[model samples]
Target chain A: MSAALFSPAAPGASPSASPGSPELRAQFPILARKVHKQPLIYLDNAATTQKPQCVIDALTHCYTHWNANVHRGVHLLSQEATEHYEGARKVVAQFIGAALPEEIVFVRGATEGINLVAQTLGRTQLSKGDEVLITGLEHHSNIVPWQMLCAERGATLRVCPITDAGELVPGAFDALLASRTKIAAFSWVSNALGTVNPVAAMCRAAKRAGAITLVDACQAVPHFAVNVQELDCDFLVFSGHKLYAPNGSGVLWGRKALLESMPPWQGGGDMIASVTFEGSTWNHVPHKFEAGTPDYPAVAGMATALQWLQAIGLQRVQAHEAALLAEATERISAIKGVRIIGTAAAKASVLSFVIDGVHPHDIGTILDRKGIAIRAGHHCAQPVMDRLGLAATARASFGVSNTSADIDALVEGIVAVQKLFGA
Target chain B: MSDLGDLYHDMILGHAKAPRNFGKLDPCDASALGHNPLCGDRIGVTLLLSQGRVTDVRFDGSGCAICTASASLMTEGVKGRTRAEIDTVFQRVHDLVTGKGDPEDPELGKLAVFGGVSEFPMRVKCATLPWHTLNAAFDNSNAPVSTE
Candidate 1:
């Protein structure tokens, strides 16, 4: 297990890229430290992840060297900050395979990105009784915005249910694609159950129905090569903090025409082109949505984070993470009293499970004391929890830095809980 | 690294396996249902009050071992006690499980093992669901309140 942590044909010096080399681990300064005197077996990648030294260095440079407000500065420092910030936009655009940089709008994260789409798109076209086709596996961020929109405009929210096996029934999504369905918002990967949804195929189906498609790619982007054009999705969103960048930064990429048609979400500074105290004109596609003074430094950090991810190569990362997932599911599922959820054929690095008698919260607390960090709760997907007939689940997600030994720590922790609970 | 104290003590496991008042109380003077939806821990709290004093207390629900045990233990500590005395117990349990301070109150003997739970922030709600329901049941202003 230790030898096979994340090494699947080393992608050069990147940790996990090289088999049997721990040098990549040093890039992340936090992995060396221990919690409760035990080495930190960090597995809660679904919630967030530890930043690499490159990302941390970018953050430091933004504050220590080229610190300035973006889009409005005239001095050298401001010019440098503006260049780096826009450079981040280009990096993010390339990362998602967007056709143009202006199509990418930097928002806070996935939550705000969803809210922006719901508010703008729903208000623009959706009328009362129109339907929004979503799945039972959607996170609260995806569900709540549509709910609020539906309630306001008398539009109804339609749910695409999942099978007992936790896979999205192939044509089940197609069945929900009614003529009344205006927008189809779904997570590219189910955060709760680690179900990797086929967004490209699903979006193609939605396009055939004339219903617009949007994806919450927060979970998918970190592990896979996300090509918005390949997906053919009308709109795609993801967060920076979850992508190894600093907090308060994310990207919402849409087709140029689709973004141009949408209205501005918030009003204030930086979104307007001209103000005469009589009538104000909005900026271009991306700038029109990015309101107020944005998190410039964080955006710079995100660019650097994307660089690090690209350095490892997304395809290699995805394959390695998938291999790790396969090994983990095989071993962890065989344990008595351990029932893994989301047994879908397609899955990301996330693994959610429940022990027979131990509460998820209890499992989390016990794991934390042992310095093995895992996310335990509903994972902000209460609807999925309800669908599975559970209140919460213990989730262990993998990242580039995660090793097979981390899974061992998790199994050991579960065994300890079983011994204590007499399960 | 999980201690028996962190998961369950012998008494808590015993009570959770078989709670004392594990049935519904008919014609109950006060009743409340508390659920930590996060954990699917649901408890029906029924109170039989005699002139503002808690003459009888019973709770039945489904949850994990720790929560079920905590709920079972809660019913025993508050039976035949006054509202004023029960409030103190609630506060003590909240503090103990939530990691504040325990003042050696005899009612909190076996419950003291839960003092180790505070380090884990997510489980605090699970351990306190029953106690919160008990407090709401004592308050007669409304029907069963949601102690989220």
Candidate 2:
């Protein structure tokens, strides 16, 4: 909780000289375990990050001390639970630089967050002949919801294409933006490829086009810092599990005016203010969106994860992960018959590649045998795969606890795969 | 219990490297597509069925090593066999891959190489996808078969 923990070189640091300091690795208990009789080298951070002991302890503490439904009872345990839940919202608001905590709504994860916006705000704003603009680099979560919304409202879903290097094509967004564009949604960083989109510039363009913007920050939030106020997007959403917190915990931050204007997506116990046999009134901004009993423990865990990241400082995390990614990219590219996907000039910490005469599933299986885990498939971005003319690619995404040694192991595993396939 | 060596045996690798009966069979009696949505592995099976017997078979698509090799070996195994005989072989192969039947069972023949697949629960579907597609082809069903 103190700024002192943000020091680049903490006291009693190991002299072994690892990019991800040994001290940081020690905080995650799973890193110490073995898989297949070998030390586990996890490289799938983009899918979901490993939780630190502090976050796990926070979940346990909340469940043990105040295991009650939030915001309903006047009992001490209920008050404590409500306080922790609301406190988590404030932490998320501050972490993402929202103007007020009331703008943040807790949900199951990024998928739910996007669906909520698509159903509520999209239903209210969209009509016939309107358009919902998205990019070709979006995950299925971002694409399907907009498609559903457009189909329901008789609107059109327009897609901006990406370059061969996986970057958004130059001037494609502007060309696609027209008077009919009602909402523009794109990912801040692609989960399949590491391409980092020009979010602020895109937001500015969307605003000028008289369109509301929603940024999928699930991949961006874990790798670096995000300030919604500076980006000036109308809404942003991210998941907690990708940030080293528990699953089923996430945040959807919208402009206060927009959240107040949209209707509640789901209806249940907590989202309603008053109820009669015939009708019901909705609660305030965030609570109106959060129906039923929330996952209070997960919220507390997410708050602890945010505080832990703050203590480490996102800038340091960004630097460490970038160094690892650079080393990985350089070493992996040197191998014969290996191709790197998504060669964007600007990217986050994801490394995706394909080897000649070898399928990604085979690569993943061989790597898993060596205790080096990576994702190998379309990664739920089939459109991106189709664009790249590939069935799938093997992806190794880095995290704060990853070191150069993990990258070395990955390179060795790739060599072994090539040998196995005789490529 | 399954090692990488056993999973990627020499036979599996050889068959995968140069798959047999790979291509579309034009003017065939029936054909069906098998898709594994989980890994995006797809394979199509086409055969010439006459008098309730498979005279010729061909399979073509993209898939992992296990899947590709399984489909290759299946094309060679199922040729010149009746539908009931092919079904019998499919049951034994299913048991062999699931570790329920003896690996040394004389009925398995070259399919014994897949005895290692049982160790990987996830790969079971990959090994069985071609057989499922073949079943669909016999029925002449146009709907694609998915190993969900």
Candidate 3:
């Protein structure tokens, strides 16, 4: 309201201020909401995002018209279904700058996508002496899978430490990338801390060391202009829900030859070339990873979600979200006893912090009562919590639909928590 | 931001801010740690039992308002009550949380306020984490209960 307020978004710009930002928010009817008799301030995009009208429409469109099971029948509906399903692949490929459609294997989301690679790629190559390089700033979804993979094989899971400011120390990451390092998997943008890793350089370093790099773009894809080609990582994964797409749908993009060589991770119907009682010949690359009845409705919604982002342009979304993050960071961090967690020099649109002496859960409950949705806890990044010597931290992540008004509400809500805790 | 005051009645925030009998018991004989890694709620319930009565009960946990309050309330409710009485209270609270049990168990006392938690599916765990931790900690008790 004052001249002192610094709006990162240019004049007349909102989160959905991109070309189709308004239309996209319109698609996600939930954005039009009120909470606890107040206007909804959804700062929990990092947790899960509100779906736009197009994503909702696409989902409804599939069930309303062509709801046939894909990759089974050769009927008119089946052909239509297959075309739309495969079309989504191209949409996602273009969305992330993947080299080919085959590289983008549709999984249940980033969690499952990470598990798929850890199970398949990890199983095939990782041996006892082999070290799986990862950072302490990973979600349990990223850490647990490799732990299981390493436990299954004789492999070891090595961690790259984070700096006090929450950025991954580049030199430490490089130091961890030794000869035994089979793979280096880290979040392109950390979910808990919102620290965006130096992907292009990090991936380049990993590649030179002959290690497969898996980038969890779950948080990044929603807030930044991410290009798989630009990063040139061996594999990249992101979730649909974070990108304003439906849940149970995600993309796992790998280099062509590397993904092609791996066997099917899960086996059922569509992933098979020929099914015999004794043995089954596997299908091609994408299908090989995509086993059983995929979430067609969700995939349809996800494709539209990506298309929605494309229409708005990633750069505009980035700018809008960045402004929100900066405004929120400066305002919320100024609150007494509230320490901002991740202070990476270069970051995306997430503002994570913890109110001193106040458990994040208490802060979360207080905020939710005010109808301001924010994520509080380890954020599935237990390793990060362990490093920070914290049980949990509260995170307020941004999206295109968010506004300065929401940040104001969040600041007020956090102040309430701080005062209540006497922090 | 208007205060949704009813949701954060002073009692709830009061309990969360300055919990009664907070922190772990050193010689925790019957202690079990139930962790909700999703929300990072961890509760360590130490039951100081003698014969059948719970005698003096204590809990140490770090979690949201509801979970900590629930843990605090449990220590108050179960103290001086027999093992069978504790079992009944646990069932009442479990049902109140997981939606399988009745929220309106008359003996549940002020703890019944958490019944509204089922409205928010995610917070169900927040409401139930302490109760679940209590059950798990009393695993050897086998005192006829249902968390279903």
Scored on chain A only, each candidate's TM-score is 0.95, 0.96, 0.93
Per-model TM values vs. the true structure: 0.93, 0.97, 0.86
DockQ of each: 0.56, 0.68, 0.48
lDDT tens per residue, model 3, B24-96? 6666657777777777777778877777676666778577777788788878888787767878887887777
lDDT of 2 by residue, A6-33 (tens): 1223234331233378877887789999
Best by DockQ: 2
Which prediction has more favorable TM-score, 2 or 3? 2
- Could you tell me which 10 consecutive residues in candidate 3 chain B have the lowest summed lDDT? B139-148
Model 3 per-residue lDDT tens digits across residues A209-322: 989999999988887778888888989998899888889988889998998888789888889899989999989989998888899889977887776676677888888888
Q: Candidate 1 chain A: worst 10 consecutive residues by lDDT?
A: A1-10
Q: Which candidate model has the greater lDDT, 2 or 3?
A: 2
Q: If you superpose only chain B onto the true chain B, what TM-score does each candidate give?
A: 0.87, 0.97, 0.80
lDDT of 1 by residue, A1-423 (tens): 111111222224452344213766777789889888889888988899788777776767677877788888688877777777787788889889999999999999999999999999888889987999898889999999999999988999999889876778778899999899999999999998889887888998999999999899999999999898889999999999997888988989989998999999998788998988798999888999998999987887788778777877788778778888898898889999899988998899999998987778778777887899998878989888878888889999988877788778888899887877687
* Best-matching candidate per TM-score: 2
Q: In model 1, which runs have C-alpha deviations exceeding 4 angstroms?
A: A1-21, B1-7, B37-40, B98-103, B107-110, B118-122, B141-148
Q: All candidates' lDDT scores? A: 0.82, 0.91, 0.79
